[model samples]
Each structure stands twice: as structure tokens, then as C-alpha cells.
Target: MIKNLLLSLIFLTVLSIAVQAQEALFGAQQIISPEVHDDASVTFRLLAPKAQSVQITGDFLPTVKMETPRGTFDGPGKADLTKDDKGVWTYKSEVLKPELYNYSFIIDGFTTTDPNNPFLIRDVASATNIFIVGGGHADLFKVNDVPHGSVTRRWYDSPGLGMDRRITIYTPPGYENSKDSYPVLYLLHGAGGDEEAWINLGRTSQILDNLIAEGKAKPMIVVMPNGNVIQDGAPGEGSKGFYKPQFMVAKTMDGTYEANFKDIISFVESNYRVKADKSNRAIAGLSMGGYHSLHISNNYPNMFDYVGLFSAAIMPREDATGKIYDNFDGKLKAEMDNGYKLYWIAIGKTDFLYDANKEFRAKLDAMNMPYEYVESEGGHTWRNWRVYLTEFAPKLFNQ
Candidate 1:
């Protein structure tokens, strides 16, 4: 009996090993193709390991759709998956429109990738493959001979967090030639992003230079700062999303951003030739950065005269009620009404935080606060933030 039991146990262990091997072989799967012209139609092909249910999700279709053998996926395009003798699955889809899109494959309840596409972007949780509908804007992605701004990375000693932190600064046209001081805009990046995001991905400096050259925007110093707190001796420490337990424990929503604000203000005032007055200083950011700007500016009423929040996340008003006045009552009345020169909020209609932005706007209206609210075409993306900065900059320093 003992011998028989040992043999059965060995057989089960071998079976487990085989199953694990099959799973590992599956890895991540995806489809590949480039963004085609708007008038031209193109096909995208995806390869998978086995016969599994796969769906295509992209900016065009924010939701997932089943992969069909030869039918359209219910939008401007369609997808078909076929299998070859080698046990590889292939899927093809027709070209739709032109725009920057993010897409992925979902297999057996897990998000996978198309092994064929070389374009990808790294986020906090996973990497996503990118496909452009048409070619991207030349000014934003490519370096040009036109006057441009430089993005510099600066490290500073943070006494509050007991570690060094980094920030990205964008100096506009004529910044180097003149001894005259310029107004500064402190731009904060969202969660899962670093100081480099606006400069690298958003093309902030280029957009500003082009806009200013066209007389559409005012030339100013744009400082993009890393909002994450680092402890002693910790290298590359940062916060990306609110899904992690540490992020929640840190109460990223809780008004701790004053530490980052103080560091940025001190660094800019001491190191750069910028106008140090509240009227000349502005603050703006996207998502988590938007939340930070709202809290920080309100808490320090005298620090910034202009404040912009793109897709701002207004948290629950602390009283578990639907009233915004309960939480921001005193500050909303005292700081935003009298202290700010221009308070602006811009958000897309499809953004997840649209409702919260609307509610906050209504609260500001009730307090008779003077501000600007703008709604545009896209969701939470750099596409919208780039345009937001272009429009918002021109309105600043006018008084």
C-alpha cells in the first residue's frame, strides 16, 4: 500500500509540472499593425498560443469585444481570428480612423499582448502596445530647428521625507538670453508618472514654444515636479496609483502634498531666475496632480494666484454626504474667492472624474468664486492636457 501511494504522488507531481509548463508557454499574446490613413483601410493581425476567447480593447472601443472568425467587432472595424497547423492563433481587424490609440488582448480573464507590435508604453502596472491611427503631430514628437525649450532634471534634498527628490523644469524661449525674471508655472504630474512624463510624453515644452511663437501663449517657466515622497536611502522611490496598499496607507488624497509644494517653491525661488510673487506663480496638473493642485493651493492661499485642475478628483466630502460644502466650506469661501487671480478647471465629458469636476464647479459657483471651466473632446489623456496647457497659458499674466 505504501509503494502504491508513493507512485500516485509522483504521478500527480509530474502532471502539475506539465500544467505549469503549458501556462508558462502561453505567456502574453497580442495582435500587431500600424495606424493607417483616415481614408485608407488597413488590416491588423493578432497571434495567440491556443484557441482561447480573446477581445480587442483600444481607445476606439474602451470596452472589450469578442473576437469573431470573420465579422466586424460592432464599430468602424472588425476582427477575425484563425488557427494554423502550428497551433498559433491569428486575428485580423480593419483600419478605422486616425489618432493615438492604446489596445490590448484579453485571454481567459487575463490581459495579454500582441507579440507582433513593437510599439509599447510602460505604466505603473503593465506595459501597453501602442498603434497610431494616422501619423502623430510632428511638433510634439520630433525635435525641430524652431526655438525650443529644454527639460532639465534636478535633484533636491527633502527634509520632510528625509531623502532626495527629482523634478523636471521647462524653460521657454529667450529664457537663456535675458536677465529679466519670468513667471513660473508649477505643473504636477499624475499618479504612476514621474517628473519626465510631461516633457517626454506630453511634449509640454515644444507645445509651449510653438504656441508662444504663434502669439497664442505667453512664454513662462514650466516646472514639472515629482509628487512622490521618498524615505531615507531609498532609491527611485515614487508613487504611481491608488490601487496599492502603501498608497492607500499613505493617504495620497490626504493633504500631504504640502511637502512637495514647499520643496518645489524653495528650489525654484533659490535656483532659478523666476518671478517670486503669488500673482506671477501658477499651478496646474492632471488627475492625481490635479487633486494635489486643488488641495495645495487652497491650503496655501498666498502661494499661487492662478490654479488649473485638469480632470480633478474631488474626494468624498468627509461627512459621507453628497455636499461639497461640508469639506471645503471654510477654505472655498476664504481662499478661492479672494486669493486667486484666475481659477480654471478643464475636463473631458467622458473622463471618469467629470461628475466630480462638475460638482466642484457648482460649489465654486455657489461661493461666487471667479473661475473658468472648460470641457473638451477627449478623455483622461495627454492629448487633452497638451491642449489645455496651450489654452490656459495664454490667459495667464494678462493682468
Candidate 2:
């Protein structure tokens, strides 16, 4: 009986090993991914013979905001993928419109970046691979045969924060050669965004380059500053720069960023030969940065000639934690009295923040404030933010 039991156990162990070996086989699991065809359709391939299923999720996918009791959000579905005989999964998208789009691969039930794609971008907690659909309005964000500008990572000391902070600066093509002082645009990023956000995710440099080359927008200096109140600089400046836990603990929504706005202006003014009048200085931001721009322009009503809010996220009056002006309407009126150029507010029709923006627009109307309102055709994604910047840039300092 003991001999028979031993033989049976050996047979079972061998069967298990055979099954494991079969499962571990990866026949066709790696290949060239995301090949764009001449007709503007895209084919994506991934090798995962062992995986049971895969799918693709991206902003390029058709977005239909389905209404739910909880709230509204992007599409409830993703593009399904198919597997080939080589164990490689593949997908082909219909001819996409020309625009920068973000996407990721969903293997089984887990979402991940494409291993074969080298270009990727991270916004706060989410990361995805990026691809540009060409030859349409997307041309504005593409690198054309234009005189490109230079982007520099620089630092400045903030007396209010009591530390040196980092900022991304963009100098137009002829900035170095000419002695003429240029107008300055103070661009801010959203929550979970840093100085690099405007440059990396927003593609500000590329947009500026293409716009300036086409003569649709004037050449200027763009100062992209970090809006995080607690951190001294972006992730690479300090010794523990990569330590992101600090970001969560750091309190920014308060009046800290706005109160310290003068420091940034002072640094840029003192260093660069920028046109020093209100007309030459413009401020704009998206989301949290929009909140900052609104507050800063209000607080310093005479500092900037133009203010832009791209899907601005506004908190209810009662929930405002920090020093919001007692009378925002009065403040905005005062700024307009000082001869403002543009008060541009843009938000997508399907944006989650649409209600907040609409309420604010109503307030602006009630106050008889002069502003430009653009209701576009998308959601609260960066795609809208980029479009806002493109539209807003040309209208800046043109007066």
C-alpha cells in the first residue's frame, strides 16, 4: 500500500509540472505597437499569448457622458482587442481626428502602459502612453518647420515660502538675439501638476512654437510655475524630490499660492527683461491652477491685463477654506476698471465642472462683467485645456 501511494503522488506531481509549463509558454507576446497608417487609422499590437483578454482605453475613444445617479463621467466602455495566432493581441482604431490623445492597455482586468511604446506622460496619479493624430487642428500641437523656442528649468527664491523654488521658462525664438523686452505669460498648471505639467502634458512649448511661427500669436516669454504650496520645487529639485507622499500631506488649496504670487512675479520681473505693464502680463491656468489665476488676478487686480480660466474648479462659498476675497465681484470690477484686455472663460459642455463654471458665468453676467465665454465640445480632460490655451494665446497682448 505504501509503494502504491508513493507512485500515485509522483504521478500527480509530474502532471502539475506539465500544466505549469504549458501555462508559462509565451509564444507571441512582444511586437511593434501602435503603427499609424497613412489613412490616419492606427493599429496597436501586444504580445500576450498567456493573457486571456485585453482592451484599449484612451481619450481618443468616443466619449459619451452617461448620466448616473452618482454623477457624470467619460465613456463606460473601452475598445475591445483581438488576439492573433501568434499569441499577440491587436486592435485597430477607425480614422481618428487629428489631436493629441492618451491611452493605455488593459490586460485581463489590470490596466497598464504599453511595453512597446516609449512615449508616455503622467498626470498626478494616472499615467498613459501618448500619440498624436496628425494633419488637422492637431497641427497646432505638432512640431512643424518653425523656429522653435527653448525651454529651461530654473529656480527662484520665494521669501513667503522661505525656500528656493523651481519654474519652467520658455523663451521665444528671437528672444536671445534681440534686446527688445517681450511680454510675459504666467502659466499655471492644475492640481497634481507641477512646473513640468505645462511643458510635458500641455505641450505649451510646441503650441507656442507653432502659433508664433504661423504669426497667429505673438512671441513671448512663458513662466510656468509650480502651484504646490508646500513643496519648494518640482520632483527633482530637493534631495527627497521624488518623495511624493509629501504632496498628499502638503496643504495647497489654502490662500498660500495666491498670497505668494508676488514672489513669482518679482523673480521673473527682476531677472528677465519683460514688458512691465499690466497689458504685457497675462495669467491663466487650468483646474486648480485656474483657481490660483482667478484668486491671484483678483487679489492683484492691477497686475495682469488678461486672465483665463480653463475649466476652473471653484469651491462653494461655504466650503472655501482659505482667504477668498469677501467680494469677488467687486474685485473683478476693479480689475476691469483698470482697463483689462480679456477675461476669457472656457469649459467643455460635458465637463464635470460645467455646473460650477456656468454658475460663475451667471455671476459674471449678473455683475455686468465683460468677458469671453467659449463652450466647446468635449469633457474636462487635458484635450480641452490644450484647446483653451491655443485659443487664448492669440488673444493675449494683441491690444
Candidate 3:
């Protein structure tokens, strides 16, 4: 067809322009230059013979992270890269722990990802090169000889948002034929992230698959929903509507996702052979999604029996947040006093919201409410979030 021919021509033209741009910027540079040694040390090489200076920055580097409320994971850490006589920039990192890390290259004060590393994670508004340090404690994120769950892109009608939104669903291996109803974990993403955030960057599917195969985790379904209330879904999904200012807002939509939480839950329960009781339901998220999980658990106590907060952001303006009770502490205490499997919170030592999470933990402790607290060494990055999920998923449905 004429239309198809025109589209193909346009694509070819764009591809040609992009290739030309890349060639102009990085001509004759050996970009894919990461060599991981047996001791977990990695040597990164970048072809930038003409650059004035280059520095490598990642979570593995040592730097003091700011303790302010809005602290970011962008800086406070960097390593000077040395350019060899061959015009290749190189930086050898210290022995890193087994985990995933996001890094970038600073070329003449400009922040850029590793040109050779094709695997990068798209964050709120930026992209970062990612590498996985294998062995030791990070085996959960690794691929193993295990039965893997399938990830499917599906849509559900959101009456509250007045649109059809997409969610990435992960049904455990054998779910297709297994007639047994399975418990579900409603996973949510952070700001500027779509449903693919967890599955791609966090490696939720691999973690779950590995854990389940090891019998460390329960074989259940994971439903990762797009947390943006204003937007129906990510680009290329065909469901995303015209951008609006409200779409930029983090949360608190009168007719947004939280308002229609039940809609997604209902659709999943109805469509999938899932267990329908509260004890069979769990919810967890990171950052903005973590805030939603906390508040949603508060607003509807009986909806989910298991709640997880990963680097949860607790606004200082306390408006029925984790800080204080809706009105009385006794009410929430009594509600929690009832049977619930687990209430877990995890955060890194350098998390900007570490103080807020500690305060929330103290509040929960003061109420004599049982909850688990995990403090790891890292910042507000996918590295910690992925570890939290690996630990959290195993703890679920155990009781």
C-alpha cells in the first residue's frame, strides 16, 4: 500500500539520520568495553581519544549522598577515567557487591551513558547505563536454569480514569495449565515510569522465577500497573492519550488510578484464575508507587493483607500519611492487630527518604504493630529496589 511504503521510507530516513549522528559523535571508538574480572571488579573502556577528560560515576563509587529531603542519586560519586595511549578512556572500579548498578560517563563535564553498553534503564527523566555484578548476594537477579514466568502486555478498562490502561502481568511458569487459583502481587512503578519499569530494570520476572524455582518464593502472579494516573499507559501502547498537565502530577487524582484501584483488582481477579480473598493479595512499590501502596493500604485496610514500602516517600505535610493516623492511632492499631501476613519496609542507608521511613517504622513500633525493617547499603536506585523485591517476594504467602 502507498501508506505502508511511505511509513517504511520515513522509518528508513530516521534510521539513517540516527546512524549518521552516532557515527559523527563516536566514530572508531570501541564502546562495548566492559570487562568483569573474577573478583567482581570491572574495567570499563570508552573510545574518546579526542575528549579533554572523562570520569566514571555510578552507585559503586564512594561519595557522601546528601541527606536532604529531595536528595538525588545523580551525584556525590565519581571516578576520574584515564585515557590510554590508544585513545581509549578507562576506569577500573573497586570490588563491587553482587547487584545491579546504574552509571554514566562524564565527558568534559557532560553526563552521558556508556556508548557501548546497549543495556540501559530509563528513569524518571533520564537514562543510565546498567551492569550486573554477579556472584555472592545478587544471584536472585541472575538468569538460572529455572522455569520462567511469562510476561504479557494486557489492557483493562479504567472507569475512574475514563480510559483503557495497560499492565504488565507475570504469570508463573505452569500458570497456563494449572487450574489452581494463584495469589497476586499488585506491583506499581515510580514517577516517570511505566509498567515495564519493574520487569525490565528491576528484573522482576527473573528474580521471581529464580526464587520460585529455588522454592524461596511462592509461585504466584505479579501485576505491574502503570502508576501514572493521568496517562493510560506508555508510548507505543496505543492507549496513551493526549498529554495533560494533570498527567505530570505524581498522584492524587480524584478519578485517577488510586481511585480506580479496585477496577484493576477486579479486572485481574475476574480475568485471571486468582484467589479472591484478602489474605491472597499483596501490594508493593518503589518511590511514588511506594507512597501509593502505603496510602492505598491505609485507605482500604481490608483490600490487601500484605503491604510493602520500598524507599517510601512520606510527605512532611502529613495529611493522613504514614506519619499519623487518619484521626486516632488506636484505630489503625486495632486494624493492624487483626491477622495480616506481613508489613515490610526496606530502604537503603543513603536514601533521601531514609529518615521518613525510619519515622514511619518508629510510628509502627510505637503502635506495637509488627513489621519488618530492612536497611541495606546503597541509595535510592534500582539496585536496592531489586534486592528489596527479591527479599520481599519470598516473605510473601509464607504465613
Best by lDDT: 2
Residue 145's lDDT within candidate 3 is 88
Query: Clashes per prediction?
Result: 6, 1, 0
Residue by residue across 117-149, what tens digits does model 2's lDDT show? 889997876778988889766898888889989
lDDT of each: 0.67, 0.85, 0.80
328 Cα displacement, candidate 2 (Å)? 2.2
lDDT, candidate 3, residue 87? Answer: 89
Candidate 1 per-residue lDDT, tens place, 168-268, comes to 78888788888988899988777666676677556687777777776766778999876654322112434332342222223344455553568768888
Instruction: Give the clashing pairs for model 1.
Output: 29-113, 30-113, 30-114, 31-46, 31-114, 192-240
| Stretches > 4 Å off in candidate 2 | 1-30, 64-71, 244-249, 317-321
For every model shown, what is its TM-score relative to the native structure? Answer: 0.71, 0.88, 0.84
| Best prediction by TM-score | 2
Error of 2 at 35 (Å): 1.0
lDDT per residue as tens, model 3, 300-330? 7788899999988765443334322245355
- Looking at model 3, which ten-residue stretch has the lowest summed lDDT? 316-325
